[model samples]
Target: MKKINKLILMVMITATAVISSCQKLDMPPTNIFTPDIIFGSEAGVKSFLATIYRALPIEDFKYRPDQGFKVGANDWENFYNSASVTGEQVGPFGGMDIGGGFGYWPYKDIRNVNTLIEELPKYANKLGEAKVKSLLGEAHFLRAYFYFGLAKRYGGVPILTEVQDPGAPLESLQVHRDKEEATWDFIGAELDLGYQMMDETNETGRANKYVAAALKSRAMLYAGSIAKYGSVNFVDGLARAQGIVGIPADKANQYFTKAFDAAKLLDGHYSLYDKNSDKVQNYIDLFLKGDSPENIFIKQYSIVSGSAHSWDATMSPRYMTANALSRSYPTLDFVQRWGALSVTNTDGTPKRFNNRAELMEGLEPRLLATVYFPGATLRGLTFDMQRGIYPSFSGTAAAEVAKQPNTRSYILAGDTKTLYQGKMVIGFTGPWTGGDELTRTGFYVRKYVDAAKPIATVDLNRSEQPWIDLRYAEVLLNKAEAAMELGNASDALTAINLIRVRAGATVYNSIDIDKIRNERGMELAFENHYYWDLKRWRNADLVLNNTRFKGLMPYYVFSENKYIFLAEPELMQRNYNFDKRFYYEPIPGGELGKNPNLYPNNPNY
Candidate 1:
């Protein structure tokens, strides 16, 4: 209930003695709780803080990138996650529709945070000085988090540090947008204050000193990136001239240094999750294990609290779920980013494998752990990801790859239940063209799906996996990127190799910006970072220009009783297009209507 309700802290205390004594109402309502009553005790403060935490704008399991963040249970299409739009996965959707965001405006949430930071200090005597400062620090961290969310979507939003008085002149309450660099500076300053005032440790999922630092590491990296690359992809207009939608190129190193310094603060405070000796299992457990050392800040979910998501239900295959089935599938293009797949022979012919799972052999354990390749098992059932049965095959993979699915020489099955020669033509977890719930890319996301949960019983809103909002892995990536940009190649190499070692992949002896970017893409895949990463790096338009993500279609040859994988365009044939104008999302039309001062909107709306 706390997650759903905004705890305003004004409650009827029902002062019975006062009510009995007063025949006529001469004083303020006795039922009302004052700011002191709310901030004076730990319980009261925690209760109030719960609302702010609930509205923290984390794009977790429930976030639909094509939609906006935090649309919640109503987002039945959430499985079409941010990865879909970024070419990381091929979800059952068309082109880039979310270029203009779903209008995420969180100034109201910011005001609540401001209210806490402003009013809490008055009760310092009631709640000890240290406690009051810590609470205020938490408030600052929250405000920074909210601001970062805004800064990423629309460049420079109105920087409202103090809560605006509703009774004041309308002109006074109506604020104009701050310079993009100024907004980013404000976020950095808030996080700095947060780090200075907060203690080292706090409860899980709440902001501590290091949590603020972790956020700073991420936010400042975005700022640094925008400053460096913002000019590369520019939209000329009044907003650009006014410095409201873009950062100056000269400020790049300043922000990158800030990011680097902030990231360095988290070095020894936390370590990567390395519980298991088996790298693949260890990587898988990094997300599932609740007490992982790598998790810096996580938004927890509990079935008992009724605040759970449908990750397992939406990400797992149709055969593995009782209700909702898989909608998002990893693309071959994204999978190849980690390393080349062994799907083809030296002569460019499709490699014949004894089993579908053998395709995973010699691949990086991290990749295997991130995606459920064909023949991977969940609960007890194999993924069984066969696209269709090929009755006969005698050609190079290139020739086969050239032919369309319908035009190809394979026997297409209507569904998994369709049989050919007494054997199921399509696998249970399928690339069945007949249905939408089946796997379209021959892979299911393995990262956050709880294999411990029984697939026969898996359903929506029952998944209890906590969403790791900030992790040491991302901080390391931030460090690596910043270090590389700052020309500190050695530090960047060390940071990347640290992740590469844990991933069981070949450690790189050399580091470059592209390497760092690729490593970030591979490490933070499907965690809702790639899309934003592309935008900040000013690569979305170039990377996604008429791009159609490919899918690894595993076809079983009935004659040889062996599987041959073919890289082909995804079935939907959806083309991902990111225009230069989409580099900055348009400010929500409603916001502009409410406050004309918020214009001129970002580039082309």
Candidate 2:
């Protein structure tokens, strides 16, 4: 059946040949389907351009692998989650034991962009200068974006400017990686070309001037931050402020200033999505409703008409959840992080609601608005918490499953007793259904799962929810942080307070240091930012030390004073040490075996 399915897809691609709608083809029909010939026509070119913007992540955490560890899915997360999976040097299993997400999408994007770079330029003159140049510019912006992704992940990666000919690909295939400095320079150069080549209003999703500028600023800020914090790259203790290492403080400011300028250009079109008319689920309303003005660049998902998996299965709990698919559980670690929000007092003291229940009870109303607590009796729900029956992960009561507690099982391999947060939050299992144990450290996400279309199906298009990539609110936080980091506290206060004032967040009347950070964690909770944000803030050691996994148990109990749900003594601890090498994931072992000359291994690997 798999073979048949593969064959059908191939046949479909062949049978549905796209034609050039804008101009006449000067080449033979055979050339029409060639990479160059196909993209040469205006309509064909537009289609290609559309294709580039269309690929996106439907699941909330594509780049984030932190949840994978929480779910106890594979060795990668196992290592990070438990701090038990160990090894520095590569023998059998030693690469990306810490965080392999860096290697996944960046390289995948590079390969795709390289294809765009190689194919588009050939038909430049033949297709007329303007059209050809526009497409090329889009490609350049995309390449720059890919480079940025790579740069953020691994310090440097192989910089392939062109597509390799399949017949003679070996030479380029085994090319060595570029120096980090050279790579960033090349990327900066690409951004320059992209900015010049693309137009903002005239361009679609493919690299517009504003997007390029925004991207450049983002790049500069990240590079600058890494360099400034001395976290960029290390060599013993000599913080190298040179080359590809980290952007110097002055350069960091320059990038932030540039980012501010680029953002200023976009100041007109975007704003925070504040339509909390329903008001009950305000936190969920802001991020998941999709109508909020806050979302600027979402990778749009048209479920029925698109190719990706519909979100129905993942968000909804089994029985009540539209499909019986497993829920993508967010851990107690994540929940507790948000609880850390109330740690700041409005009166300039730390109020610290470190306990889960206390955090939930004292939590700014925003948290409850976003979650579907078991037995929650808000106007939208009804269920018995003691019976292990609560609102479904899908948020509709009709689809929920009912089971006696002592009987045990939530329709998956994950154990239900691990329901420390799920039981408290949405009141459903992880919304999963494959095996039966249901092993996870957290609960299912209630942020985006709507009650309306609460059934799972093969169809992927559902307009009810639009994913938010970067909302204006995020920008506010981003700007505030940048300003604060750059010593512009007044601007930071204004930016931070906007969100607080709107949410009626009682924790801060104005920007308090702890309050602002807490606000970000709680407001942005489970939009998948916990682990990385912790790393960036340099709080990983304290946080990770407590996050370590043990034996095989999915949940971890922070020391009594730290958290409510504690880990059993028998849980597996996959790794023990936070070796610096664990920070960057090495290229996959599979690729390494193919070509040693590719410098096949991450330095430590």
Candidate 3:
């Protein structure tokens, strides 16, 4: 069966708007569908629904910290994301300052969804009652999804349930922000409504009952964390009074229970994708294959319809990529946490490895799947990432030669001692700071890259890999985390072990909050969950205060015929001071200027 091409609908609708906007608003274009005409037909309603889907804040391939979601015609070079901010990974050149404010006020999208909800019922004659209600359910889900995005980032925002008139009094339009608790409750209620009204099966890329439940699972988990872990001390007097940013601690369990229950609803419907015999390959295949049972909700992309991303071009290693270079470099700090092959020895002591290769011998399969270390192969080529080789010398000469610059090239044992040979042999995947394409942290990203795409050619549109928005693995982790927080160890271990077993890791007999958090970090690295996870757990300030993320320098020793790894602070100075006030992003200055009612903005704005 052919895949449902939603991008075609999106293109048609966007084209219509572009043409209509170019002409005068007072005079309707010669041949165009106005808002009224568009909503009057069932096909037109689906077209509008396509627009709503396109505007979702999935934070997929186009997302960057500097620019928000779905950025078009922006420089792809400045592609740093939440992973960079959280110290899970560093950029190719150096560490980036996490200063860009998250100005994600999707009020416009919410308004569009509100307009759809208001109009869908009116066309019940043209579209059947069931179809109208399902569409309305999707609209509610979209609104809840947008509000949830806002509430997570900037606390409570104004909830506009119905479409407001442009000519209405400014005071009436300037709706007060709801309490953080109420906003979360509203999201949960809307998801419940969506789940009830949505069909069990619908068109691909559209939200069904399972999708609604998956969203509810994530939303409730965020709400539960905020209620339990967020600080009440930062609550501003005016903002608190206006119902903007504080949730009582007592309400934690209620939200956690909701998250757990919602997640439970998808128990048998989805399972971890473990089709490949090679565990590492299995983890990699999970992202490449579009029809995995683990994927609950996905944002589909189509190269044929001119809707695609540059993720492959932007993230592949320098040697592998065609135009853009690798941007996200996994950090040494994150790599160490992946843990050695065995956590403990038979005597219950921490396990240790004699050599660098031994250290990497039995790592959790997920770590290998997620990161491309020095010797990993990609697209049929091995990444020989040698910072510098240790020169072969006698006792006194060896000590002097060892003092040479580690970033410079040296002759290898098997190669000829010619100038050209030495230069060509070294720094294949560099730790050199002189260029834009070199890997400064001695690593390249492996996750979310399309290995099937042409690595040597710069074709952005051909990068049609689907972005998995809500995967069942995340839901399972969510269930485990909530269960752990609620002190249900049995349930927590049950959920977590399923993930561990799938990844070919040793299952835990006992687990703590730290174990769960680390597991989540390892499993979901570079998937855009760690940054928010740190914030919601209230550990961002402690973990990232005035710290420099670390990197590994792997150098091959010619005499020993083995590789040696040096773990040290990254060459570039990266000072990351996470101010407590950053827990809630400041309300956008433009929004505040438009409506002073959003006054007394989030603390420390």
**TM-score for all predictions?**
0.94, 0.66, 0.87
In candidate 1, clashing pairs total: 0
Across 1-605, the per-residue lDDT of candidate 1 in tens digits comes to 13112334433332111100001111222332456556767766765666667677788887766666554556445586889888888886668877877888998788778778777888888888989888988898889989999999888889987777666688897789998999999999999999999988875346789989989999999999999989864677889999998888999999999999999999898999998999999999999866788987877665654566788888886678888767788899999998779888898888999999898888999999999999889998898888888888888988988876578888777777788898788888888577757877788899998898886668888887778888999999999999999999999999999999999999998999999999999999999999999999998888999998888999989999999999888776788898888888888888899888888888877
Where's the lowest-lDDT run of ten residues in candidate 1?
Answer: 16-25
Which 10-residue span in candidate 2 carries the lowest summed lDDT? Answer: 15-24
lDDT of 1 at 371: 93
lDDT of 3 by residue, 1-605 (tens): 01112222223454111101011011112322455455667656756666667677886666775567754565344346778777887763233354436587888778778877877777788788988889888778888889888888888878788777666688898887778899999999999989999987676446788888988989999989988888456445666665578788899999999999999988998889989889988999998767788887776565545556777777765667677666667788888786532423454432332333454566778888888776676677777666566553223322332454553345432221222323433455666555556665777777877676666654454576677888889998899888888898898899889999998899999988788888898888888898888778877888887778877766655655555555546645466667777788888888988998887788767
RMSD of 1: 6.6
Question: Taking the candidates one at a time, how many backbone clashes does each contain?
Answer: 0, 47, 0
lDDT of 1: 0.82
Model 3 stretches astray by more than 4 angstroms:
1-12, 15-32, 75-78, 92-96, 232-237, 241-243, 340-359, 392-425, 458-461
Q: How far is candidate 2 from the true structure (C-alpha RMSD, Å)?
A: 10.8
Itemize residue pairs with steric clashes in candidate 3.
none
Better of 1 and 3 by TM-score: 1
Q: Per-prediction RMSD in angstroms?
A: 6.6, 10.8, 7.0
Candidate 1: segments with Cα more than 4 A from true spot: 1-32, 71-76, 404-407
